[model samples]
Every structure is written in C-alpha cells, then in structure tokens.
Target: MEYEKLVRGDVELWKRKLMKRSSLLNRTAKKAQTKMNGLIPEKANSVITESIKKMVQGALFGSEYLTKTKAVRAATLEELDKEVKEKLNFYKKAAAVEGAGTGGAGILLGLADFPLLLSIKMKYLFEVAALYGYDTKQYEERLFILYVFQLAFSSDQTRMETMDKIDHWETYKEDAEEIDWRVFQQEYRDYLDLVKLLQLVPGIGAIVGAYANYNLMDQLGETALNAYRLRWFNERENGQKQEKQSGL
Candidate 1:
C-alpha cells in the first residue's frame, strides 16, 4: 500500500506538470516551428501528411501480427511498473541502434529512418499496453495508443488538450471516432524536425541520431507509464465508489 501511495503521488505530480503552461522558451520555439511549417510547399505537406496517415493506420491495423506480448493479469502495480521499465530500456536500445545504423550510412539511409523509427515506437506502445493489462485487440485500446503518442509529441497547447481527453477517457471513448491524422502528422513532424534534420548531416549524424533516438524513447516511456497510472488509479477509485453505492 505504501508503494501504491507513492505511485499515486508521482502520478499527481506528473499531471500537474503536464497541465502547466509552456515556458517562454518553449513558446518561442513553437512559434518558430509554426513559421517553418508555413514555409513548406502545399504539395510537400500533403504528401508527408498522407504518408504518415497511411503509416499509422497500417500500424494500428497490422499490430496484431507485430505484438507478441500477452496482456499481463493478476499483477500488482509495482510488478507491472518493473516490467514496463525493463521493456522501455529494451526499446530505447533498439531505437538507438536503428538510428545509428541509418544515420551513419548516408543521406538516403537517414531519410529511411523516419518510417523505421515510427514502427519501433508503435510496437513499443503496443507492448506497453499489454504490460498494463490492456488488450490492443480492442479498437478503443488502439485509439488510446494514438492518444498516448499525441500526448508525448504534441506542442504544449495540444498536449494539454490531449491530456484532457486522456484524463476523461471513459466518457470520451463513447463518441470517439478517430483522431485527425493531419493534425497528428503535422504535430509529430514538427516536434522532431530539428533533431531529425540534424541527423542527416554527414559527420555528426551518427551521434545525433543515437542520442536523439534514445532520448525520444525515454520521453515516450515516461509519458506512457504515467498515462497508464492515471487509468489504473481511475479504475480503482471508480470501483470504490461503486462498492459504497452497493453497500447503501
């Protein structure tokens, strides 16, 4: 129970951090990213957006064959957290290696890293869902994975909006059809644009690629862990309320 209390405290702190307004530096950077996004040709933007849309849809529909991890049941939160952390480390290493290999090769290979890295991230989320005792086979659960992805990579404003949806997922799920793929693609591409661009440079590409990929995975791991914790505590509180109502 002590561990549960500590975990709950961590989740509360994380939620507060998530909802906080962006700092001046972040706001400035976001403005610059917006300007850069606006400068891109419409045709280029359309192609990129369509590609990401198809890639993500493919991931969601084809994930059943990709994810081998079974849903974990009958485990304490502590046990689940331990396994999740271990799996996070494993994925980080894999991403780093992929980044390095692609980055070190040449510009063509570096360009190829985008879809490969996306696949790795999606697979990692699928496994994390199973570890948290959620079945990705369910359509809603796959949508939840997309929300987690958006939460981790979106701008500060979008992050808060996504967090609100995640916080009230049970109610939100009732009417949720699908996410806006254009918004999803734009936000994700903007978030990684600078670092991934640096990963194309000849000399420093290898180092930048490895460091960027590792840190990206680390960020996703932290976000995914806290997102699941929110759901875990929500379910527990709801169960308590139901039990009290029944006793009455």
Candidate 2:
C-alpha cells in the first residue's frame, strides 16, 4: 500500500505538470510553427511524411524488435520502473549523440536525423512497453505506444484530446478504425518546428541537435512511463471491481 501510494503520488505530479497552461513561449512557438508549416516546401513535407509513415509502420507491424527481445516478466511496479528508467537513460544518451553527429555533418546528415531519431524514439518506447509487462507484439499495444508519442509531441489543444483517448484507450481502441497518421505527423512536425530547423544550420547545428534530441528522448521516456502507469491503474481498479462483484 505504501508503495502504491508513492507511485500514485509521482503519477499525480506528472499529470498536474502536463495539465499546466501553456506559457507565453509555448504559445509563441505554436504560432511560429503554424506559419512555418505553410511555407515549408513539398520536398520537406514529403520527407517528414515518409519518415513518420515508416516509423508508424515499423512500430505497429515490424517484428524485428519483438523477435529480438522477450517480454519482461511481471514484477511489482517499482521494479518495473527501475528497469524502465535504466533503459530510458541509455537511449537518452545515445539519441543525444546521434543528434550531435548528424547536426555537425551538414544538410545531408541533418536531414537524415529525422528518420534516425524516429527509430531511436520508437525503439525506446517498445522497450518501455515490454518492461511494463505489455506485449509490444500486440497491435493494440503498439497503437497505444504511438498515442504516447503523440501525447508527448502534440499541441496543447491536441494534447487534451489525445489525453482523453489514452485515458479510455481500452474502450476507445476497440471501435477505432485507425489513427489518423496525417494528424500525427503534422502535430509532431509542428511541435519540433524551430528546434529541428535550427539543427540544419551550419555552425550551431551540432549543439542544437544534441540538445534537442536529448530532451526529445527524455520527454518521450517520461510520457511513456506515465502512460503505462495509467494503464496499470485502470487494470488494477477493474480487478478490484471484479473482486467486489464476485464477493457479492
């Protein structure tokens, strides 16, 4: 019970933080991103579109990661969290390095960073989901993982809508046709607008790229952790409800 309370406390803190109103900087960034999206070229849009499609496909349907790794045996949430954090830290450092290398390599490599970073992020989520005792091989679980990604990168407006979707994922996912990948790609691209563009600049790109990827991975890790917790809590409550009904 003590452990559960502590876990709930932490989750509540994160939920509150996520719900905080957008700051001036965040609003400004969103507006700037809206303008930039309109000005971006067809080639740039295509690259982003294609990269995200590949990412979603690999995460949802690819067998490579599932084949290579076993589902983590269920343990207490505390134990699971420790393992998840270790994996998150490992990937966080790796992604930062990848960003820096590409950022320093000029236009070609900077552009290459998009798909590379997407792969890194997706891989980390797969591991985190497995660590939390969810089977990454399940299509529904993978779709949940994608929602976690969107939650981390979406605008304030979209974030609220996505939060509701995640909160009722078990019920909502049953009837949902499929995620609107176009909206996912747009929200993600818009979220990264300035920071990603800065990564293309010649002199300062390395620093920007490294910093951006580091934080990006960090945010994803945190979001995934909380998302799994939300699922666990829901299952826990449902179990309790079933036990009560059975006793009656």
Candidate 3:
C-alpha cells in the first residue's frame, strides 16, 4: 500500500545513474576545454577573447548532454504497473500503511515549471552545440515548441496564471535562459490553429495534427543541422558581399 516508499527507492536508484552520467559529461567538457586551449593560436587574440571562445565551446557540448538528461529523467519516472509495484513494495503490513496519495500536486507543479526548465535546457544545449561548429537554432526552436505543446495539454486551464507575470521570446541575448511558459503556450495554440487548416485534406484526422507537429520539429532540426553543412557557402557569400561593399 505504501507506493510512495517504493517509488522513492526507484527514484534514488535512478538518481545514482544520473549522477554518474553527469560526472562523465563534466569530465568530457574539461578535456575538450584543454584541447581547445592547446589548439588555439595564443598570440592572435587577447586572453579574454580566447577564454570566452573556449567557454562558449564548453557550454555548447554541455548542452548536447541535455538531450540524454531529458530522456533519462523521463524514463526514471515511468508509470508503475502491478508487477513493478509488487517488486518495489517489499515492506510488510501493506494494508496497515496509508497511501501517500496521487502525486497530482507535484505533477501540477512540474507541468507548470517544466516548460521554463526545458527552454533553458534547449538554449544551453544550443549554445554548447554551436561551439562544436553545429548550428542548433532550429533544433532549439523546435524543442521549445514541443515544450509549449506539452505545457498546453498538461493543464486543464487554457490560461496559465504564470503568463501575466512574465515575458518571452525576446532576443536570445536578452533572456536566453528564461521563458514565459504561458506565452509559449499561447504561441503553440496559435500554431495548432494554423495546422488545423491542414486537417481539411481528405485522409487527415487527428493523426494530421500529430504529423504536422512532428513534421515541423523534424524540419526545424534538419534545418539547423543542414546550416552547418552549408557553412562554407555562407562564408563565401559573406566574403563576396564584403568585397562588393569595399569596392563601393
């Protein structure tokens, strides 16, 4: 009957695994920083400039680890079935103990807060990825959109109280780590409405919505990755533009 104790134990085990993963990530970042310093031309730039670039690179790689972190965090809290419950609840006097109650309150709090956390994670991940010569803006944007969709469906109230107190989607330089969950939800709602127009197609149903949502995400992610591949073209174009301006 004491499901809470069982769940807590499971969570503890999962936490240990997470901690190990985090340790490995930290070690990798440290090694990367070392490598970057060794490779950069020491005399070409000021110490501050070189240090900043290295820090940026470290942050970018750190963000890639966020993807794994998110997946692991979700798997750690999977719904408990009867078999899992039995295995977890080894404590005797099962009927004598009171249920700790549905984690509704906790879930509500997480739903309210997860979008903001996820946004921070995405931006940080993008920063880290960008350092490794990867353009992750599209992936970050798509993930942000997915987080918005999740926030919308997680709560019954269409209007979240948190929206009134916060702002969102400012330039990345302004508040890269902060996101207004309520505003994000409103944006997703608008996006969802636009996709609804596509539902008029003959074979499209609820699946149409699902396909649209994921298709946009896939496209965004692919765009971000593709930008890296086209970097040489971009550099050439920029060079030509600069030359034209100089000639003028």
TM-score of each: 0.95, 0.90, 0.24
lDDT, candidates in the order shown: 0.90, 0.84, 0.35
Worst 10 residues of 3 by lDDT: 94-103
Task: Specify the highest-lDDT model's number.
Answer: 1
lDDT of 1 by residue, 83-168 (tens): 88999999999999999989888899999898888888899899899988899988899999999999999888899989998989
Candidate 1: regions farther than 4 A off: 39-44
Give me candidate 2's TM-score against the actual structure: 0.90
Residue 24's C-alpha lDDT in candidate 1? 94
Tell me which of candidates 1 and 2 scores higher on lDDT: 1
- Per-residue lDDT, model 1, residue 205, is 92
Candidate 1 global CA lDDT score:
0.90
Candidate closer to the true structure by TM-score (higher is better), 1 or 3? 1
- Displacement of the residue 247 alpha carbon in candidate 3, Å: 10
Between candidates 2 and 3, name the one with more favorable lDDT: 2
Off by over 4 Å in 3: 1-186, 192-216, 227-232, 240-248
Clashing pairs in 3: 59-128, 60-127, 60-128, 60-129, 61-128, 63-125
Residue-level lDDT of model 2, residues 1-248, one tens digit each, is 68878988888898777777689999887888778777989888888777788877865555434434467745788788888889889999999999999999999999889878888888888887777767876778778888899999988888888888887887888976667777799999888877989999999999999999999999999999898888888888988999999999
